[model samples]
Every structure is written in C-alpha cells, then in structure tokens.
Target: MHEVSIMQDMLQLAEENLRKSGCTEIRRISLRVGLLSGVVPEALSFAFDVLKSGTSAANATLEIESSPSLFSCGACGTESWYESLRFECPECHGILILQKGGTDLELTQMEVSSTD
Candidate 1:
C-alpha cells in the first residue's frame, strides 16, 4: 500500500529533523490528515507500526487529527463540511467549489527527547 511509503517518508523526515536538533528519541508524532487526502487512518497506523522498528520513532505514539472537507456554494454562498464527495450544495442545489481544509496531509508536531 502507499501508506507504507508515506510512513517511511514521514519517519525519515522525523529522524532527519530530530538529528539536526540533537534529539535521539521520539516520543510522539502528530499529523493532520484531511478527508480528501485519500489516506486511511487505520492503514496509516498499520504502516507506522510496521515501519517504526529500529528508528528514532520506534516508541513514538502517532496522533492523527482528521480534517473535514469543506465546500462553498457558488450561487448561494453557503459553506458546508463533507465527509464524502459532494458536487452540489445541499441548501440551494448550487455547484460547489472546494474552499480549503481537506486536501492536505501535514505533519503538525513532534515530541522528542534531546540528547544532552
């Protein structure tokens, strides 16, 4: 699955950043995943469990915050949050356009132990 590759990249990035900051242990990794990001949380977790071995994040807890897809109606100016694909507005039956907040997968925070 692609989640494995994604998790691998995330771990690599985390290790690189921790190394630069003189951190040797990772305590936590937080991510913001959007509905439109096409990533399954369970699959990502499984990927993390499989890929964390022998890395700085081996013991780290992964925290995922889900973001809902937002769409705005072009005709009615109504905004709505969607958990599934929606092409039209529910209020006025207008064409809906993506506004923001559900198309990105981002690393938000990391907790690490500094090597003194």
Candidate 2:
C-alpha cells in the first residue's frame, strides 16, 4: 500500500536526523494524522512494523495523534468538528467550507538516544 512508501520516507527522514544528531537509537516517532489526510493509521502502523527491522527506528514506537476534520459555516462564520462528509453548517444551515487543520500528515516529534 501507499503507507509503505510513506513509512519509508519517514524512516529516511528519521535516519537522517539521527545521523545529524549522532543518535543511535530512536525511542519514538510522533505523527499528526488528519482525518482527511487519506492515510490509514492501521496500514501505516503495519508498514512501520514491517519496515523498521535493522534500522535506526527498529525499536522505535510510532505514536499517532489523530486530528479531526473541521469545517466553517460560510454564512454564519461558525466552526465545528465533523466526522462525516457533510458540508452543511449546523448553526445556520449554510454551506460549510474547510477552514483550518485536517488534510495533513505531519511528523511532529521524535525521541532519540545518542550513541554516547
């Protein structure tokens, strides 16, 4: 799946950062996944498990923080959380537009140990 490629890229970035920081072990890789990012968390976790072997992140834990999809009412200027594809505003029954957040897959933080 595409998650494999995504994990590969994440691992590459982690490795690069580890090298730059003189770190030999990665303890955690924290990610922020948006509801509308189109990336499956289960698949991404499986890919990380399968691909981490023998790498700097072999023992790393993948921590995912899910971000809910949010929308703003075009007519009322009200914002709310949404889990479905509904684009109707709850307050004024106006058309809802995506205002902030969601639709993103980002690496937020990493915990690592130096080679020392």
CA lDDT scores, all candidates in order: 0.88, 0.87
For candidate 2, report its TM-score.
0.81
Instruction: Put down candidate 2 lDDT per residue, 74-99, tens digits, no spaces.
Output: 89988888755668887889999986
Minimal lDDT window, size 10, model 1:
80-89
Residue-level error in angstroms, candidate 2, position 22: 0.6
TM-score, cand. 1: 0.81
Please give each candidate's TM-score.
0.81, 0.81
lDDT of 2: 0.87
Predicted structure with the largest lDDT when compared to the true one: 1
